[model samples]
Target: MTRVCFELRIKPELLDEYVARHSPVWPEMLAEIAAAGRRNYSLFVAEGGRLIGYYETDDDTAAQAYLTASPIAARWEAEMSRFFVGLEARPDEAATPLTEIFHLADQLAAASTTSAEGDAL
Candidate 1:
């Protein structure tokens, strides 16, 4: 699986609405997302309307293409675009993912062991 991350800006005033809408994602939309090959998807928001999205997919290109080509995606994007800013076209087509700099699960555990063992010695 591949990890994907993207950043977008939401309207400050619409943040509550945005969050509310996602609180109970539409069953059909969720189903479409899954059918498009996305898994473990999540979205995070920060003050001033910064939005971050993350997901794991078997193939990012295929997943995105599948979603964007679907009529459900078009409908969803039309509703969601009202809450966003700086999109060239629509939410579905405008996403530009960020490059991953580092990942530290095993690395952190291994590095911490050296410090813990040295303290005992």
Candidate 2:
């Protein structure tokens, strides 16, 4: 699975409303996300309105394409766009993935492989 992360800024004045809106995302929107192949999704917000989102998918391209074509996703994004700052496109479509610098699980797996190799030597 590919882990994806993105950053966006929410309007400071609308941050509370944004969080409240997500407290219970629409059921159809949630189902559309699942149908698009995204899982383990989460969103984090900071005091300054910085928003970070993360999700994992087997194929990011396909997942994105699926969501781009989904009517539920379209409605959700349209409703959500107002809360975001400086986005010319829908929030979902505007999400540019953040680079992953580190992952503990990957490093641990590498360490295990190196140790096993040393044991054989």
Candidate 3:
């Protein structure tokens, strides 16, 4: 599965409301996300209006296409559009995939090797 991560900023004043809106996501929306092949979906927010989202999917483009075509997606996007900034399109369509610069597993392996060498010394 391809892991996808994306980010956007919310309006500072609406951060709490934005979080509240997501607290109880509509059941249909969750169903649609599953149907679109998005697995392990999650969203995180920080104090400075930063929102990060991640998901695992076999095909990012196809998953996004499925989301864009859903009627529930249209309604959800319309409702959510007001709370964000710097969106290229609707929230559903505006995700810009982030390029991963590093991964923790590789660092952990390096650390283990260094520790092993030190033990041999």
Lowest lDDT 10-mer window, candidate 1? 101-110
- Between prediction 2 and prediction 3, the one with superior lDDT is 2
Q: What is the TM-score of each candidate against the true structure?
A: 0.83, 0.98, 0.83
Best by TM-score: 2
The TM-score of candidate 3 is 0.83
- Summarize candidate 1's per-residue lDDT along 1-121 as a digit string, tens digits: 7889999999999999999999898888999999999999999999999999999899989988998888887898888999998787888678768998776965798779988999999
lDDT of each structure? 0.89, 0.95, 0.90
RMSD for all candidates, in order, please: 4.0, 0.6, 3.6
Better of 1 and 2 by TM-score: 2
* lDDT-best of 1 and 3: 3
Write one digit per residue (lDDT tens) for candidate 3, span 1-121: 7888998899999999999999899999999999999999999999889989999899988998999999998899989999998876898788666887787987899999999999999
Clashing pairs in 2: none
lDDT of 2 by residue, 1-121 (tens): 8999999999999999999999999999999999999999999999989999999999999999999999899999999999998999999989767999999999999999999999999
Sort the predicted structures by TM-score, highest score first. Answer: 2, 1, 3
Q: Which prediction has more favorable lDDT, 1 or 2?
A: 2
